[model samples]
Target: MVNHNTQLLSESETTISYANRGLNYGDAVFETLRVSAGKVLFWEDHYFRLMASMRIMRMEIPMTYTPEFLEAEILKTVEAEGQKNKTYRIKLLVWREEGGKYTPTAKDVSFCITTEILENPFYTISGDFYEVELFKDHYVTAGLLSTLKSNNRIINVLGSIYAQENDYANCLLLNDKRQVVEALNGNIFLVNGYKIKTPPLSDGCLNGILRKQIIKILGQVPDYILEEASVSPFELQKADEIFITNTIVGIQPISKYRKKEYGNTVAKELLQKLNVKARLG
Candidate 1:
């Protein structure tokens, strides 16, 4: 128990696959989720997205896999990683493997359940802040793999590298039209006077789990329906405070965007309420 610090799958877990569709043609789908307090939040939604991706790709997966099983795996991984630390992150990866040649085989499946070792503290809007910039060189559109969470993440990797080189925390990615679609990994939320707005899925966004959760949580608050539409760069620049949300980061506020200071504190309050609801939701 002490030796196994985390419960994630390594490439050595399996022998040579049959035809190796996953390795040969990059035919795989996966989900990244957060494990905390011995529970996986919004497991159902993650499953829904995974299944949707599979359906789009004409792949089959075990739909009957219970939430209890997912919880058990996540707990096992968390305990393995955080044996004495008591906190960890989990990444459950499912690969569509064993298909022959370039096409998927009749019946084949393989998976890796890896638990990356956790660090001292996770980043939330409540913690040390970060800033972003409007990236110029690279962009992502909805036409190619936009609806699927495939193994292709080269765009995000390049964008992150560019941000790091520029001494920024993250990069706010826009489409060809240069409108605010999302962050490299998460979805963006712009705060105006008593209103919250985000880019619609039509604007080429990932439709993150936390993004949906935030909208669901905020939609019940009477005045705030948390609408989504095409959010332009001009409108985004005028925002009070901008925040991004995804699985691991939870929620993070941008103190500045490309040296432009957004002096609004609503992100802090929204994050506080969001954390409370996430814990109790």
Candidate 2:
């Protein structure tokens, strides 16, 4: 089931127009949310981020779109799918109304909510070996627009194909300046000793929800120092640990990058704290 502009419909009945702007021009912004026990984890952050992304894309914010209203709609869709009591992954997509080429015919927007069940209710570290390689074929332009979760992801799509062809679990994307921006799917963090480094939003990494949570968690701890700085490719070989973060995975520790292998000491510690925060919320 899916919610199209607050109207619940089965997958077969939910029909998007042939000329839908989102499908035609990639003019859309979306938020991926994790819900557990019928509550959205980090709801406030996700809501604000969605609003911000819509604003950045110049999409009109409907008068009816409010924190409470959107949250209710999301939960309604989840319940309709019979996932009200189960852990689920929900995607809320907002797109401009059909009609336009490069310029939109109207600023008015439409939204859809969809859900899928997740295997775990809380975040857990995977014991499987995960490896990544650099995708140097393209570069993410460093700017504010790159930080938005809009539907401009050709680089990510290409990088995923490259990773698969090369037998790597994932690929690290670089900005025009040759600095490691992030992994294809999420934000990247490098841990060296007690210091942790993640690229700032200015470096073109997605303003990830889990990245913010991890930063807040690290700030409260006296042992580790967190830095919102650029990550160089050279640092990858020297880092003691590397972890990728997103709404779905929470924290995925990268096991290998070429011949260099990483440990999950910090990643494990942070995941425990993250789960605690999620439960408390």
Candidate 3:
């Protein structure tokens, strides 16, 4: 069974208003985090991202909700769920309070902390490669909120559903200009010979935390070149290898996209370094 612990500002309220703007108008932002060995990995980065997202939405954050205090709340919930020593997926969702008529009644934010104990003890790179396809029915728009991890996720949801129905592990999403943006659950990377290419933030991809870390990792490697450029479906299919990154999965290699088979040499090497960085940190 999964235990849910929620707190709103200073109060532990179970029920929010029916007119909550988050529920009604999707006026909210969230962060999906990985918690291991009683520590939330990259806590400061995640918190700052959350703060930035809230700021973009113009939500009035509570004065008492400092990073230290919020981290304590997350720890409290993790401990209460008996997952202090285990690995789990933790989500922090902050939403605008109740409102009406496409406008918020209040600018104050109400947040919740939920943790689900994961079956795996640690993040294990998948032995089986992910089979992915391109999703093109709808495109994500490019704008100010494009990079934020907000509640408006209809495009991602549709892409995920398309992947499941078509017997694929994941599907790539395109932007309004038909450029390869990202995958259903993570950011996409294409390996062409010695150069690595991923869509830039301007391509309407979420500024994923893991994506940033991977870019930093590649910068230190002298042999490989990492480029953030506009990529197309044809270019992605012609790549030498494909990989994806996210907070929970770390990095996963794509074994097959359509009929093009890919080798996981690059992904395997990176996963090793990423795990080392995690352990050393």
Candidate 4:
């Protein structure tokens, strides 16, 4: 059940303005942080990213995120929820909740952290071999809003709908230039022998936090190669193994892409190493 505050307090105080940017138009930024052991894992990283996104969007975080208030409020909220010693999902959204014209006159920020059991990425869900469609050149597409994590997620939403409709576990979205950018949700990685490859940031993808950690882990190994090149369908098929990383999904291995089942030991091993890194890092 999605427990949105708006749903529960619909009649309380309608801050209805003629037009607020968030409602008139999708003009806001948001982030999701994972909670573990009563503390948010990579919380600093998530805050930095959220601040970065606000900077890109020319927005400001509320006073609550200031140096003095940030940590205290987060702790209080976690304790209020009785989420200690458990892992949970935390979502922080800041937007122009105040509606006015096409631009933002004022904004409202919202933060909610809830408890839900997320599956461990190393543990693949019990499902048959899944199919992955090779995305054509999508790298050439315009990425005007690439830097900002805006609420306008038509592309991601469309891709996810397609994946679910087509029975593929995930949809590999490509830019206009036909390079493997990422899946609908997670950042894409391929493990061919000892070499690991993911699309470069120039390939028009978010700098996902988990993606950064995986890159950092791969950077330490001499045999582990990280490539930021434009990868095609053929290259993905030739790879020995494939994996995707994101905050929610963590690291996921692709059992099959199209009819090709790329079940490799290296991806599984990398998954194991990533779990340790995530838990201990």
Candidate 5:
């Protein structure tokens, strides 16, 4: 089932025109959310981020897009597919109405909601051999627009293809300044002894939902110190541990980067706290 502008439709009935702005010009912003047992995890964070992204892109905000209203619409889409009782990955996309060329004729927008099943209902640490390499073929621009979750991600698509061809689990992206920004799919965090560091949004990393949660979780833990600062490629080799955070995976520890291997002791501890936070929410 798919929810198109509050209307429910089957997969076969759901259709998009070629003139759609989102499809033609990449004029869209989206949120990837986790729904477990009919509840959206960290919904407030997701909702606010979506609203902010839309505002940044100059997309018209619908008067009816209150947090409560959007949440109900997302749950409605999940229920329509009989996934209200299970863990599901939901994507809510908002795009400008089709019109004009580079200049849109209207500020009005449209939306869609889609869902897929997820294996885990809460955060978990995987022991698989995950490795990553730097994707230097392209660089993300360092600015406010680069932080928005808009559908202008040719760099990510190319990095994913590079990772696949090189037999790597993931790839880290860099900004035009050549600073390590984030992973292809999510935000990156590096751990060294008691210090934990992740690139700030100014560095061009996505303002990830799970990244915010983990930052909060780390703040309450006196055992480790968290820093929202710039990260360089040289630091990746010296870090004691490396982990990536996103809405879907929660936290994924990188096992190797080049010849340097990492341990998951901190990743495991945080995964437990993350699960607790999810359940309490």
Candidate 6:
């Protein structure tokens, strides 16, 4: 097996402590980044979201953890593994330093960068659609925390397990009100001709970076309008098409939900737009 270590500096190595708040109490925020040719995709957006999450959790952002600084660290970690020329997914973890499980002595934060190899630098729309089902094991609570991707992710963990056990490619999560929130790992979008509907941050959906990008791209189209609203499973089942978006996969089309089948008409166009935008940058 290959050895992978969490890097703190270019030449230094460190390991998480037994008292780390992130380990014991899930007190951390992380960004799953895509790296192609040594450059991070949507770096500024990811950096700002990480900062926002830290502030929301009352953890001080280290002055040295600026976007440019962190980007260099990510590249260093990738190059260390001799994978700088290849595509991969890197996780940037920012956590509160050693502290009591429930209460902390200080708000200081620390970070680590880890990488995983990916097969492709750009998303390739799969010819077959994703299989999905509803996950009712838990309902996400709508609040400030719901909008951030924190370490407390037992809900998604369990949802993923359910999907695998049932042989599903993905599962939909619902908020407490029984409204569709998102997929196990990505944001959900429903297409109906010229309109698109997705759960809003107010509906307990994470403010995913790709979700923002998709909405921005759709807004630029004169004939399309993307609306963030509360969605129900019934509405999802009735949509003309359904797709999920995440950093790794720009757009994943859903083929079947229950007895209804969906087509990829809109997903194809959006995927093209996303790829073009990514390449132009």
lDDT of each residue in 6-39, candidate 6, tens digit only = 3334324444578888898888899998989877
Compared with the true structure, all predictions reach lDDT values of 0.70, 0.94, 0.83, 0.65, 0.93, 0.85
Candidate 4: lDDT of 96? 51
Q: What is the clash count of model 6?
A: 0
Q: Write the per-residue lDDT of candidate 5 for residues 164-237, one digit (tens) a residue.
A: 99999999999999999999999988999999999999988899999999999999999999999999899999
Quote each prediction's TM-score: 0.84, 0.98, 0.93, 0.82, 0.98, 0.94
Worst 10-residue lDDT window, candidate 3: 1-10
List candidate 5 segments past 4 Å from native. none
Q: Model 1: which ten-residue window has the lowest total lDDT? A: 1-10
Model 3, position 161, has a per-residue lDDT of: 91
- Tens digit of per-residue lDDT, candidate 1, span 108-157: 45555656544523435545557788877877785536646777677888
**Residue pairs in candidate 2 whose N, alpha carbon or C atoms collide under 3 angstroms:** none
Candidate 4 Cα outliers beyond 4 Å, as residue runs: 1-20, 97-99, 107-128, 134-144
Task: For residues 66-142, write the lDDT of model 4, one tens digit per residue.
Answer: 63355445555555555456565666666655645666565555543333545442334334565677533233243
Candidate order (lDDT): 2, 5, 6, 3, 1, 4
Over the stretch 80-183, how does candidate 3's per-residue lDDT look in tens digits? 76547888788888888775567667767777877777776555678875799889999988666889999899988998899889899999998999998998
Worst 10 residues of 4 by lDDT: 1-10
- TM-score (C-alpha) between model 3 and the true structure: 0.93
| lDDT value for model 1 | 0.70
